[model samples]
Target: MIEPTHYLSSTVKGLKPSGIRKFFDLAASMEGVISLGVGEPDFVTPWNVREASILSLEQGYTSYTANAGLLELRKEISYYLQEKTNVSYSPSEELLVTVGASQALDLALRAIVNPGDEVIVIEPSFVSYSSLISLAGGVPVSVQTSGEMEFKLQPSDLEKAITDKTKAVILCSPNNPTGTLLNKEDLEKIAAIIEKYDLLVISDEIYAELTYDDVYTSFVSIDGMVERTILVSGFSKGFAMTGWRLGYVAAQPEFLSAMLKIHQYTMMCAPSMAQYAAIEAIKNGKEDVLHMKKSYRQRRNLFVNALTEMGLTCHVPGGAFYAFPSIKETNLSSEEFAEKLLMEERVAVVPGSVFGESGEGYIRCSYASSLEQLQESLRRMQRFVQKQKAGV
Candidate 1:
């Protein structure tokens, strides 16, 4: 028989599996493993939000929503964005609901990228950015951001990465794996370069509500950026609604319309019940978000403090639930350290190298687990570090 691999798309064939899930799968196969690999929230979806979805099902509202999603949910999303970022999107023309923020991102890439277009991706970013860009037939140009700079994209570095073929930039503030929040001044500087280059921006703000020390600023809120920004966010991170698979994208009508064409053909619409729940979430879930944010802040402090005490040299994360700590002092590659920790200590984390070249020498530990689990994992990690140092 002919090999099935011969039939696979070259783009799909070239894509590597998610580095985060590799450890998660290993932990699943083992006994008594503590996994800090995945970035999901530890909290459950708020009762009110879940109840709304349940009620929708009871009302037999399981039919497909409009291709763009329910107008009510879109209106709520518009209001929420305006309230948070002082940027308003017309619910009818500028918003498209997607299965998840990931899908929204994929749609944005598919809509905007043409063959040979170059898209700049800021690294150590979410693992999917580069893959999705490649699948969109665009060359993913990585601009490495360092822990020395708090993983914030420097305007100079971004300028260096741009070229005549560069079409857009993918930016994730409150970035995954690193948890870095780019402030207004930082964004203003980057925005200047974006304007100078006449490039578009795909801003992933999924972790906006999880910010700890500073107020979350949407990239489009920067002067002269609204027209060029495609804002993708969802209910997963903040509202503990990951399993619900609900997210939305906000952009200018031209971009949104293009994405909508792809979304309509592929996804048709987001789940009807989840859309109902999202409506409730945006309307009444502020308190729930605040509660979860407070818990994550506390966990971030505890986890980062423990990592530092163990000599891991972590930068205190300003948002999101991850703590990216340097493991270079241990004299081990990130993969070696993470593999040894999992095998020897049954504590699972993602080696940062999988995120990008700049992510080498670090490991991403999510603090989204329970306090007790986090404490136990930290103890195990510390013991593992000591053993590695002692060379026994």
Candidate 2:
């Protein structure tokens, strides 16, 4: 018999499926499941953005765009970054459009990682960072963060993780699963370490616009940091444009050119209409982004309060739309807690262990759904917790 597994690359065979998707799949099979697992926004793409894409199609702008993406879109992205973060990037030489922030990260890794080069990854982060690093022929060294520190990556830990072979570090602000935004002071400390080690940085800022903190800071905006940082961002989380398949990377030409080579050979370019619509988004979509951010803030408060009141200690998320609550009181592994909660109460959430070993005693619940849905999921979770306490 022919076997597909035999033909798989070692990397593909070793890679595990995303932990978030496992709960989502289980919830789909069950009736009446209230899911808070995925980090995706439930909001539709704002009308103006959609209209722009539609208009592009109507105008026969369906041809493949330049390999780096539309010049106009790149220009807008440059302006947007400068306006928001005070960072200046040359659109022609320092930016490359990608399928999504995921691809941007992949391109960054592919461009820099030689076999056996080590990349430091902050733990309990988005699941793909380690896997992608491994797939890029780099070794992934995890540095765990803690809820006590609001899951912010510590510079001491980062310094300890580096070795002679270390090449880069991956950072996610307004982090997924944890929702901790790295503030300027902490980032300055990290910048010092990166400078000391001469390591490149892949900064994922997809959730920057959703921050409820003081202001979103860009790694590239930091003095002297732009030369060594590859900034990855997308329209997904902020614009509710997950399906648009649009993202970009900004770096000095040295790194950007290398990443562009991989992108040119692999993806060719991002979708044409999406590139056009993204130009519109950058120019006129601030109001919609703010509106969604306000809604997410309310949901974050509601979800965090509900979790704490139910006896699960939860840190208030500074940004992004997730509430990561400690389930250590139940003495259940994260997977055990999440599975039992879903089986008993028909509520779905991601087990923390999926993100990394440090997440074993917690669970990640996204508040990106409607307030009504979040409330219902909380009620079910509360009842489930009560049952666990009663040992029923």
Candidate 3:
């Protein structure tokens, strides 16, 4: 008999499983584990957002929305973006509501990437970026960024990565795992290189509102970039609405139209109740977002300092809730360090090697847990580090 595995798509067979989820699954199966592995917000979805969804359901608004999503939600998204970035988009023509910012990203990739096209993905990036590119039939080219440089993608480095087959770049600010926020100056320099290459950019800004020290700059707001940028964001990170599964994409109509075609056929529309809730979220969720941001900032401060105090060198994250600390001093690979820490201390973190080759010596610890949990995890980590240093 023919093997069933032989019928699987070559692309699916070749793909590796998520590195973050591997540790999360192991921690999930074990008791007494302090998981700093997953990057989800610990906060409950704000009351008002939940109420809005409940109201929508009570109103019997359970039917599928338009393929692009409800016009009202898209309008709210447009207004929110305009208020934040001063960039205007026509809700009907230039916006699309997706299942999540992740879906928006996938749609953008699928819309633009042709088979064999090369897309530049900066290292230490969100794990899904490369995988989504491959699923879109594009080649993912890694451009390494180091902790020494605070993991910022330098313009010079970006220029070196581009070739004739290069199609676009995937940029995430207030980045996942590292929490590095690209400054306006950094963006301007990078924007110049993008213009020189005439390349497109898919900017993932899911953590836009979680920025602590500096203002979050939208890539579309960069001069000459609005037309070339596909802005992907959602309520997941900032609004504590990951379970809601709502996100959006804003781009030129030409690009939006293409993505909409795929979205229409595949997703049809975002959940109707979720769209209603997202409308409420973008319209009146500011105070709740501010509260969450304040809490995440406190956690970040406590967590990064604790990591440093434990003798691990960690770059202070400007946004998002993760702390990537080098584990090189322990003389263990990233995976080995994480495994030993999990087994010995019952602390779970994602190994940096899974992110990219450049991420090899670090481990990503999310501080999205409660303050009490973070404190206890740090104590356990400190003990583990001391033991490792003593060669015990």
Q: What is the lDDT of residue 111 in candidate 2?
A: 94
TM-score of each: 0.99, 0.98, 0.99
**225: Cα error in model 2, Å:** 0.6
Q: Rank the candidates by lDDT, best first.
A: 1, 3, 2
TM-score of candidate 1 on Cα atoms, chains taken together:
0.99
Worst lDDT window (10 residues) for model 3? 277-286
Q: Please report the candidate that would top lDDT against the real structure.
A: 1
Better of 1 and 2 by TM-score: 1
Per-residue lDDT tens digits of candidate 2, residues 1-392? 99988898999789999989999999999999988998889999988899999999999999999898999999999998899889889999988889999999999999999999999889898999999999999899999999888898988889999999999999988888899888889899999999998989999999999999568888877778988999999999998999998999999999999998898899889999999889888899999999999999988888899899999998888898988999988878999999999998899999999999888899999889988898899889898888888878
**Cα deviation of 272, candidate 1, in Å:** 0.4
- Count: clashes, candidate 1: 0
Report lDDT (Cα) of residue 276, candidate 2.
85
For residue 158, give model 2's deviation from the true position in Å.
1.0
Candidate 3 deviation (Cα RMSD): 0.7
lDDT of each: 0.95, 0.91, 0.94
